[model samples]
Target: MSDIRPGGPVFAPEEVETPPKEVSKSSKPASLWTDAWRDLRRRPIFIASCCIIAVLVVMAIWPSLFSSIDPFNARTCELATARQLPSAGHPFGRDNLGCDLYARTIYGAANSLVIGISTSVFAAIIGGLLGLIAGFFGGATDTVASRITEIFFAIPSILGALLIGSTFRGSGLGIWLVVISLTLLGWPMTFRIMRAAVITAKSQDFVIAARALGAGSARIMFRHLLPNALAPVIVVATINLGGFIAAEAALSYLGVGVQPPEISWGLMIADAQRRFLEAPLPLIFPAVFLSVTVLAFIMLGDAVRDALDPKLR
Candidate 1:
């Protein structure tokens, strides 16, 4: 046998033809997204919810892609297509003004989603900050914030939104009014949740350690406590999204939401109410869309809750 030269790419005694490392058949590699996707796929409700939401989102963003007619346009009498039943030309049939109902519904879905998403973001930011403040700092600060939240909570959300919407009607403040009203009432719940989380976190060893290490109050609260407390806040925010959508619809139905010349699912339902016996498609289509949107959000939230649950992991 020839002797291998020193430092000449010589293999160690144990390196020649080393057996491949054995991968256990029973144990699998771990991946965060893969595990989450597997868990989500196993739940039929979650899959269905995701599909429904995806379809709605697509419709909302690209109504023209799905339909030829302009959703906002009022078709002329020459079209002569008003009240036509669902068929090859008009699957969802025509509305009172001969405009394509399918096109309008798609636009309406988009409008509702916009309002819902916008309002939720506003509420989350305002409420989350207030909650963090109240929860992190106890004593007079907590008491004052708690009282303010209680006052807002005492008033029904719809009634409050109605008051704001009606007041700002025709002043080009349609959607903004609704968003501000909802945010005002929405922050209370988040505040309460944050307070509890802060109280619990303040007593933790890590927080105490940070404080002893010369971390400022703001640093301790924001850097250490807030991040850990965000799990519950996110879960609550997800569930609240459905509520926000439904609330917008309810406001519109009552003539206190998105005003005329602007389409919303609630407004569509309201318009459909008068002609229910004559042409039910207008009412039915929007109702179906609204219901599906709300249900999808709820299901998605539940799926997220399960996915985030430490016990399940």
Candidate 2:
């Protein structure tokens, strides 16, 4: 092709001018939480789990919103309606004691969640601190702390709870007993996680830089190491929260957890287990609630774990 503008002085290719290429701007990389949240927003599993958890949380916080029946009131129990199946007025039907099974299930959510969450918090704090201290120091302190952790880890949670419950025979141990047992048994896992994380983080360039900058040990540990070391702990705690709830149910069923007067899914199952042949709804309703709740948490934890770990993502 020729530049046809009649024979005006045609410019050679070498003399022609061209536009310059545009330079691209660089942006800062997203932080861990930002990236995790972005990934979580796009995943249907995360969304579904979060929605399920939100409804359960609301039910736990305000049972009246979902169910008008008061399970706590002894007067509400009708001998005539005992062991009844799902009906028009009562969707979940009546328990062995004739109390509305739906109402009791609703109320039980709060207790189970409390036990699980509180135990997780307590265990994480206690274990995380000990781990931080041991990992940061990495000497005799590490050896002693590690030995202690190992000792505690050796004791199975259920067995320990049973031992403690038997020691107090006849004297009822309330919610606190279960909380204490779970916390005691659960911390070792958190301790191991935090300790490993801190060990890895303490040797990183950021930690060395902080130390070189004259930051104190306490400052370096809490301000630097702890934050970096929290990812694994958070993941473990989220999963453990669900385990604790299931454990609480198991313990209560075995007569070692929250006793009479306190309502829990485990206790409900225990109550209905004896006569489950006569009426299965009482056992099934609470069992279903517990299973669904545990599943939701586990799902949430798995989603979080995948988001946090780039390899998994």
Candidate 3:
């Protein structure tokens, strides 16, 4: 006891490390779509594509917002003003008939986007519902649906459209005819994808649990099954939407799509083809717009697909 020479305490409180609180098991996990949205936000491709698509959608809804030139005003043309090349005042040049190529091209976007989006949505809804019913119930329903989808798959959509377009006689209804024709053929692919998705989703543990809880078929399908099965369908629908727009152009070039004065890119391209050697800008401009629009949709679809797919993640 007499050996404590420094008059200081030898021991200090030992530093104690606190353990981290464990995550509670009762907390809900992030859903697939939630994770997908988070992943999409980090992707540059998704962002760029979304921007491009948004601009295009705005252009489609209100083309006058982009260009002040009247697309359908043929009286603005003169013999001397026809087939002029691109310049400062009239960028994108004048068409064979002297209409403003720039304005016409901008306006044409509306028709393409409307038909594409409308057709795909219609096909997806009708086909998805049928596929869901077939896949969920199985047996005779499945057999019939499978047969119908296969039959449609055997026929090329363009060929079917050509045949149907030729048979249908109408002046101003060419665009509607093309939409109808695409819907008829477009549904099969959507149906096949949806049927597969539904079959997989219906067998999941959550669906079984819902069944055990005595949920009816309609409730289980709408509340549980449809949400899970929608990702692939959405991707397919998005990708197919671009194809439908391109198809509208093709049909128009063939003289069966949106008629004169309606202002479609395909119609513009068709008019410029003959005079391509003299004024290539008119053709080039519309083609470029169409390419960019379709590419944007496809890229958007691909980004969405990658984000939604758990395997990819």
Candidate 4:
């Protein structure tokens, strides 16, 4: 078409000018973690689980904030008030030993949180490191590590914990005994996951490029492979934290974990089991709290897993 105007010079087809093209600046693409965070924000399950965990963490840290009674003090108990139902003062009532059930439940949060968090952290560290080294190096190192992991993996976690707890009974190891037991049994699963992740990630283009660029073994393994491999490990760890809490409770209930002078949900349940026929409040309260806490963690893990895995989304 011609650019024709009454008072302007007519331009030839070759002389006609076209407007410059506008270059739109594209925004950076969202990363996997960024997408997951955005997804989690919209999930009701994630929000609810987080709230429950926050409250439980606070209860673990400051039991006195929730309950005024001295839960740890057995001296304050009176057999006259033993096995009483929930009253105005004690929402969960008194245990068989006349100890405040509410206060014990509040205090019990600390032990469970401690065991769960500590075991998860220790297990992840040991397993992640071993898996990284084995997967990155691959050969005899991988063979030996896999062999060791298989040996441990072959044993059921709860059974191993039961055997360890039973064997070390009366050794005065205290809560650390449970922590150690769980950590030892828990690492194999984490190791296997991390090793598989590393094996997959190391073969990716980015890692091969990094290796070609002369990155060191440690650098390639941690700087490149670890971040990619960590998502599944984190999901597993979150779920295992809940499982560890339940395992501790079972061990405690069986009289092989968290002895007297150190109150845990399991210990309280064990004490209450004898008097359950007369007053179920003692067993009911602690058991309910334990169940809720475990359920919350498991829910949180499921939400996180769903958010993090693109396939699930």
Please give, for residues 1-313, the per-residue lDDT of candidate 1 as tens digits: 3357775565546546879999889897865445767787888888898899888888888887888777665542224766788888678987777777887888888778887887777777787888888888778988998888899999998888889778777677767778777888787787777678878888999998998999998999789998877766776777788899899889989988877788888998888888889989988998998988988998888887787665775
Q: Candidate 3 on 181-278: residue-level lDDT in tens? A: 88998998889888999999998999999999999999988899899899999999999999999998898888878888698888888988998998
TM-score of each: 0.84, 0.90, 0.90, 0.91
lDDT of 2 at 233: 88
Candidate 3 error regions (>4 Å): 1-28, 171-174
Q: Give per-residue lDDT, candidate 4, residue 108.
A: 92
> Highest TM-score: which candidate?
4
Candidate 1 weakest ten by summed lDDT: 71-80
Per-residue alpha-carbon lDDT of candidate 2 for residues 70-115, written as tens digits (9 for 90 to 100) = 8889998999989988899899999888898999999999999999
The lDDT per prediction is 0.81, 0.90, 0.88, 0.89
Better of 2 and 4 by TM-score: 4
The 10-residue segment of model 4 with minimum total lDDT is: 7-16
Off by over 4 Å in 1: 1-42, 76-80, 311-313
Q: Tell me, what's the RMSD of every candidate?
A: 7.9, 5.0, 5.5, 3.8
